[model samples]
Target: MKAADLFEFPASIPFADFFRADALPWQWIGQIKKALASGFETNVPGSIPPGVRISGEVYIHPSVELPAFCSIEGPAWIGEGAQIRPGAYIRGNVIIGAGSVVGNSCEYKNCLLLEDVQTPHFSYIGDSVLGNGSHLGAGVILSNLRLDQKPVKALVDGKSVDTGLRKFGALVGDQAEVGCNAVLNPGSILGKRSLVGPLTPFKGTLGPNKLLVSKPETSIQER
Candidate 1:
């Protein structure tokens, strides 16, 4: 694999850098598409039945389970063994990865949820990237669009990176855990294995294995 394909992220780039208004222009949906395509063919191959209702172009892998109450809009991919519980709303251009769980009352739009990700309660995720093994606690929410309704951008290493999209949410790295009722603002990021305490409003970049109790008050500790 190409180095660009391996890490798929810029080198030494701060997580907060992904939100700067002047960050480099990156095609996030394209990256997600590439990632899904690189893996298996089905959205939830070997799990979901072909007769399930998929509105629009979608890819599902084997072993995916979609209950009748699940609504799926396409340009979306559901990976192997992923479960879409009842009352889940999955909008277009989202990638739900292998073994992930999208629980009841959860809504996802234009996001990338990597392998083993779980959002097990009332959650709203939009234009976000949830890394492998990440989990969002109950009532967690991510705000992708600014209230002013301007385009979203990313900051990388102090440089501005444009996302070229009007809506974009948080980017949670591998194994991150967001606590219940927490809010991840637009362009926020949680580095690998980071933890966010309940009711926290995360507005900036959180480093790898960081423990975030609230905004600007986070610690780095071993799990």
Candidate 2:
């Protein structure tokens, strides 16, 4: 499938021209940081509002609602109407699209969140791309690196395909719903509108419109 097929960019949240390059979705994964740097120099959407603690050259839109005490490093951009709650830490090389939320006590780095996406509450998103309207439930962790610190890989066409990046996280498609406390291992890809059960440990790829449920059988003996 094409990169456009994978990333659902809507009117409310549109990705910059960096994604317009003629490349596949997987090929662009490792190049996100460079793309962000280049975009920061050439074209950044908006301005950083006051009352936010900015350590680096962050580009935040005027319409964004950034609460006080939110820490933002440079090479990052937040779009219009985005909500970054207090204590939300945004590291460098990140792009948060319009109408998104990075809630309190959450941390995200080197990630892209499309418009209307919700990653609210106690989550960690790194080196990943979240599609439009996608919602990551509270306490979800998108694992960006493996234990061995080797290059991350994905299950594509039933084979392990190298992502060529030491730290690569999941690519969640549009409107996908991940339940609370889900752990998305390195190179996980959740297709459009898919549902991941609560507390699921997910790795590899889940196709579009599917339901992944984990029900552990429990014996009800004498209480």
Candidate 3:
């Protein structure tokens, strides 16, 4: 339940080697081993143009943007100007930062999406982290378990934080702004410049410049 009360540090975004809370009650396999030591990568696509089927220890970048029956699988990393628009479905230790924007039928696993984040259309981010320039509007769905699924804890600033994992999701911070169809449940923590409106259904923390507009009308102001 630590990690400095489930992440808040970002005064200037230099998370050194990325992360390292010394395993203070994290789960999802220590957040996928601190997102594989925070140097996560995976944006494949080196020929397979016939129909598309990238899977060779992915790490694609150079103006990334794949569509056609998308099926990326590997130590995933599609950063630099990311934009996997069509039938998007990324798997494996994901990252997808940079210009981030995974639209159409979006679906990610072991997520991170930092840089200019944006789950464009139908979102389904897993084991989350979506921070930098955040923006998940259309159908934003990020509930990583815990109806009785146990092991999902994070209620920082008021205590109760214990993300020993059972598939923890939602920790959205940075330039947060989730609206349309928003439903970040689990360990939801939209801080820095927060604001969740349309169809909201958030959970735990919503502090820094908060403005969650739904369940009980939150509006902690700051920005």
TM-score for each candidate, following the candidate numbering: 0.75, 0.87, 0.32
The digit string of per-residue lDDT tens for model 1 on 170-203 reads: 8787788999999988777676778989998877
Candidate 1 stretches greater than 4 Å from native: 1-30, 33-53, 153-164, 215-223
Full-model lDDT for every candidate: 0.69, 0.78, 0.70
Candidate 2, 1-223: lDDT as tens digits: 4456567555543345567535556555655577666645323334444656776666777676667667888778788788889889998878888889988889988888888889999999998889888999999999999999999988877888887889888888888888999899998888788888788888988887877867673121211
Quote model 3's TM-score. 0.32
For candidate 2, list the clashing residue pairs, or say none: none
Tens-place lDDT per residue, model 3, 103-166, is 8887888877667788889889888877678888998899898889988888866988676777
The TM-score measured for candidate 2 stands at 0.87
Question: Which candidate leads the pack in TM-score?
Answer: 2
**What lDDT score is found at residue 8 in candidate 2?**
57
User: Is 2 or 3 the stronger prediction by TM-score?
Assistant: 2
